[model samples]
Target: MPADPAVVDTDCCIVGGGPAGMMAGLLLARAGVRVVVLEKHGDFLRDFRGDTVHPSTMQAMADLGLLDDFLKLPHTEVRALSGQVGDEVVHLADFNGLKTAAPFIALMPQWDFLDFLADAARRYPTFDLRMNARAEGVIERDGRVAGVRAATPDGQMEVRARLVIAADGRRSLLRDAAGLPVEDLGAPIDVLWMRLSRRPADDPEAPLGRASAGRMFVTIPREGYYQCGYVAAKGGFEVIKAAGIEAFRRDVAQAAPMLADRVGELASFDDVHLLTVAVDRLTRWSKPGLLCIGDAAHAMSPVGGVGINLAVQDAVAAANILHDAFALDDAALDERALAVQRRRLPPTKAMQSLQVLIQNRLIGAALSGRPLKAPAVMKLFERFPRLRRIPARVLGLGFRLERVTSPDAFSG
Candidate 1:
């Protein structure tokens, strides 16, 4: 027989401490609701997680009075976006025109962002963050979720709560355990991620990607290096590996000519990490006593790099909609928790719809060795500088930008 689980109680038990989980925990704890966030990893030092904090996110941080402190962290700001299309460099977006406090995308490592949020949230009396605690299954009572069973370094533990939220990335174990169905929107390409030292002279801020005939190369400027990606067609890594790592490096250099000099830094295949691209969404984002947000609700492609922003927005929305219930001391949180899904589902579907459209219409074509002819509509960005605001607004603000609307108990 298995050992008895140690039981702990909380108002809200959140699984998987990512963008959504951390943001929600902070906001709820601020509202004086007991929150327990479980992070499987002891530290948030993973590479190649969501790195772009969109202007919408920055604006939210500003609204929460954390902008100044947030900016103190080491980061790169992208005020404008540019890409090489068919041997020509074109300005894609101009964030300087956006109507927000911070009108640029802050490219900070996901680990740093998570760490900062966790530190800030720890200030709240109701915040309980347990690192190295991996949620194994959902605990249910009377056909409704009541808590979570998690595995830790020491032993199995049970956290009983009024509600459980799953923010555990795309492959959410909690979501699977909850039996929520997912819709696969499909992805045409996978990315091989690696790093190359950045030159002091390189353009520190560049657009999302540099794509050409059969290649899409993305290089993000970090503190001292370039985090690069080599995108390939679905299930295409075998062919790439067979051709050898040198050939792959040469192809990446060819796509993004600016990195030609440092291509040799990718000395072996071990240096490259393959990220299988997936675009999907859950059929239903909520259940009787459980809710799923962020990548657990929907997984986005790398097209706009807006997944993290959307996930954070989901957190804000969740806190806004459900905090009142907890604040009112409601033990039966079923209907209100479902309201979170009702409020956020539209925006989640809208973003995923747009991503699927772009993946099918643009990225898929690019990955298939087809040359992308710049549409005449794009000429407006070049001709009328003000027109750049269109895409900048979309990329920065997204389909729906959520703000912190819940009352903070600390303010009282």
Candidate 2:
């Protein structure tokens, strides 16, 4: 624990400004709790962040009455998911016929989404966002966590709060500093993310994937280009590099022949970046005055692009529990924190299990040059459109979907 030279005070202090932390701040601020959200980065412009906003998240915006305004922002809506299986094109998951107002997944840049949430949070008088503020460790008072020590853009500082939220990402600083045990379920593959130009002549218009004997390629349509992902085996980048960038480009062209002409545009490896995917959860998510949500509590794989949605759900549950707890100035913050874990852990475990299964069953085989076989149930889902609803329910709505139940639901 860093000895505190406290410089700030609030009812609640959140250590991250991603979906979960910002949403919690937004809701808590509306409920009249003074809260501060610390984001180490000054902006959310990083590329390769998950851009899929599933129907569940759109429904949350509707519940908040911000759906119209949110849709106004530039985005591409993927109504149904289709992909090319080995030797056969398949209809995988469909989002149409869903009960939600917006049934499709919204494909907006991740930064724009965060900016929208941050702008919404600013409407609340109790919310404060500190940019370029990185949390160093917890500040302990007696047996409970009382504050956070951080290295700010200016200098070292401490922020004291009644409750602290660790929403910082998969590799979380606060979670580590608090001595939380993480359950690493492991991932079999990593992703190479890059972009390519999209001309008007491109076919197969919706976001989809291509799988061959040993490789997988996914492309998400953007305004003028495609955000692409190439899956590689665990610790396999070295092999990809040894094969050379031109060889890699040929591999991409082979996986998705539609972009064969554009493969030459890949240019250099610098244009590509690696996302070492993992799916894991913490043994415990709360201790004393602290609570962990989102990636801090459970790191998710990018299988369904549902990680961001799940994190936002965690935020709603946390705000529903803690906003009023701060208003009462209660002493049993540890209990409240534990309650948040209880509400979120089951769903977290379930989602991670599903992700790990996909990683082991689907991705592992794809990387090892085995024929990609669609599961029998998935084939049933394709033939009988009614059965597709089952996956739509799981992929779109999530296992434990959360609605904002706070008295201050959309006010923020």
Candidate 3:
């Protein structure tokens, strides 16, 4: 017979150790609320994760007094964003124009950022992080979520909490188990991600986008390599593979001529990882005793690379909205959960709408193999250099950025 599941009781239990879960755990625990965070993976080293930490996120770090230390980590900063179309390099957004502590977007490995947040949360005795804990489903009692059932390395465990938070990614088992309805905004492209060695003579810009007739490529600079993305039509990986690695290499070289010499580094299809783009969000983000945040509540496209920042924003808003109920030992948290959804829904919808717009307009056209040229908007950036701040503000700060207002019990 199987052993009895080990039971852990806390004020709040969060599933998934991604940005949303970690930031929420850190903020709530700092407010003297007992919290438990479950991460399915033993470590935070995943390559498919987004790495852009925009100004809004850094502002929250600065509010928590961790900005200086966080910036010390190895990262590449992009002060401006630019794209090349048919031999014309047109500047898009300028992060340097934004007024924030960290004016540029910092590209650091997602694992490093997660580790840093975990370290900060560890300082508070109220925080409990369980690695290798995969949440199977929610623990429902009396028609409301009571906790979570998880499989850990040791054995099956049951975490009982006053409230359960599903911060899991887009394919959240918890959200599925809870039976929340999703609205699909639709995405027309899939991205093939791979790493190419960076040469000293390569473009110094941290991120550069390239477009040609029927092809699009984006390169994000890292320490010794570039994290590259080759965009193709949705559900098209099979076709790409059937064309063989040689043809694939030619396509990539055609998209970004600068990487022509290094195309051989791809070696085989195994070097490329496929990311099926999705743009979706839940209609209702909460039920009686549970709340969903981050990708669990909304899945974004790779357009502006704003997923991480948006998730972080959701975490902050959640912590601010629900910290009091958890700290004060109030068991009635249903209404507060709905309030979080209400407060975050606007920005979530706005960003997703913007992503869908770009996907349908810019990305769809390029993927169709049609002759592409710089859009008229490119001329506005050139004509008025200060206009770059518009995209910069929307991308860096988001439509509605949340501030870290949760009281810190350790502030004494």
Q: What digit string (tens of lDDT, one per residue) describes model 1 on residues 1-412?
A: 9889888999999998899999999999988899999999999999878799999888878888999999999998889887765666667799998889899999999999999999989999999999999999999999888899999988999999988999999999999999999999888788888898887575655645776777778778877788888878889988999999888888987887777888899888888888999999888888877999999999988878898998999999989888878645444477787777788888777877878887776667678788776556666678888888888898899878887888788985
* Total clashes in model 1, counting residue pairs 3 or more apart in sequence or in different chains: 0
Q: Write the per-residue lDDT of candidate 2 for residues 21-108, one digit (tens) a residue.
A: 8888888887888899999998999888999898888887887788999999999988788777787777777888888879989999
List where candidate 1 sits over 4 angstroms from the true fold.
Answer: 202-204, 327-332
lDDT of 2: 0.87
Candidate 3 local lDDT, 62-171, one digit each (tens): 99999999999998888999888777888899888677889999999999999999999999999999999999988989998999999998999999999999999999
Worst 10 residues of 3 by lDDT: 326-335
Worst 10 residues of 2 by lDDT: 324-333
Q: Please, what is the TM-score per model?
A: 0.96, 0.96, 0.98
lDDT (0 to 1) per candidate: 0.86, 0.87, 0.92
Reference-based lDDT, residue 293, model 1: 93
Candidate numbers, best lDDT first, in rank order: 3, 2, 1
Clashing pairs in 3: 214-369
Name model 2 segments beyond 4 Å from true: 1-6, 328-331, 409-412
lDDT of 1: 0.86
Clash-forming residue pairs, model 2: none
